[model samples]
Target: MILYIKYMVSLRCKMMVKEELKKLGLQFVVVDLGFVEILEDITPKQFEELRKNLAQSGLELLDDKKAILIQKIKNVIIELVHYTDEMPKVNYSDYISEKLNYDYTYLSNIFSEVKGITIQQFIINQKIERVKELLLYDELNLTEISYKLNYSSVAHLSNQFKKVTGLSPSFFKKLKEKRNRNLENI
Candidate 1:
């Protein structure tokens, strides 16, 4: 039996879900970001117990098809932006469509309707967050960060970063450096 889980994004969440499944004596074949495949069918009592337990931890057991699809979409984007070392070479729409086995238009419409943001916007937002993370790490220069994030040029990255954050990338980095210096002095 396959069960979809909402808000199971991080490795820590995965661990929690695994522990929950073990506690319920539910043997799982796969426990991924958004879904789990168990070796045996879950009973109604088990399902309800699992749902209540997950809810206490701010996670949800999803049953609605549209909600499951949306969670799947989110999981894909989260995995891509936060986990992967490199972005895919193909267009984001094509990548998402292929990954979800759904038409791009359909996915985009549903995602926008449910999330109140277009998929492109979501991708850009995620990219900007990733840029912030890279900047804070201070291990990569702007040029390197641009190339790593697959921006066409540093100027383009700077423009987008400024647009999203209202602060230039260098300024954002400076803020992090200042914070570190203050902490060190403390």
Candidate 2:
């Protein structure tokens, strides 16, 4: 059985889900960001118990089909932004459509309606966050970060970063205050 989980954004979330499943004596074939595949059919009692426990940790078991699809989309974007170090050569719309097996128009409309933000905006936001992360590491220069994020040039990246963050990349890098957006809000 496959189960969709809400708010499972980070790698820590995957580990927590695995640990929770083990504690509940449920055997899962795999536990991922938005879904888990279990070895056995779950009883209602087990489901309720697991659901309650997950709720305590700011996670919810998702049952709605639309919500599940949205979560899956979010999972893909999160994986791309946080895990992959390289920018995709293809357009994000086509990449997402191919990955999700849905029309790009439908996906974009649904995502915007549900999340109140365009997919492009979400990608840009994630890219900015990644730039911040890379900057904080202090190992890579602006040019390197731009290349890694697939920006056409450092100037383009700086412009977008400033537009979204209201600070130049260098200024933001030096401020030292941590700013992060909520995953669901993104």
Clashes of each: 0, 0
Q: Per-residue CA lDDT of candidate 2, range 39-150, in tens?
A: 9998898898889989999999988888888888888888888788786899999989999999999999998999999999999998899999999888899999999889
Name the candidate that leads on lDDT.
1
Instruction: Give me the candidate number with maximum TM-score.
Output: 1
How well does candidate 1 score on lDDT at residue 164?
A: 96
Q: Write the per-residue lDDT of candidate 1 for residues 1-186, one digit (tens) a residue.
A: 999999998888899999999999999999999899999999999999999999999999999998999998988998999889988999989999999999999999999999999988888998999999999988999999899888999999999999999999999998989999999999
Runs in model 1 deviating more than 4 A are none
Q: Which 10 successive residues of model 1 have the least lDDT summed?
A: 78-87
**Residue pairs in collision within model 2:** none
Each candidate structure's TM-score, on Cα atoms with residue i matched to residue i, is 0.95, 0.90
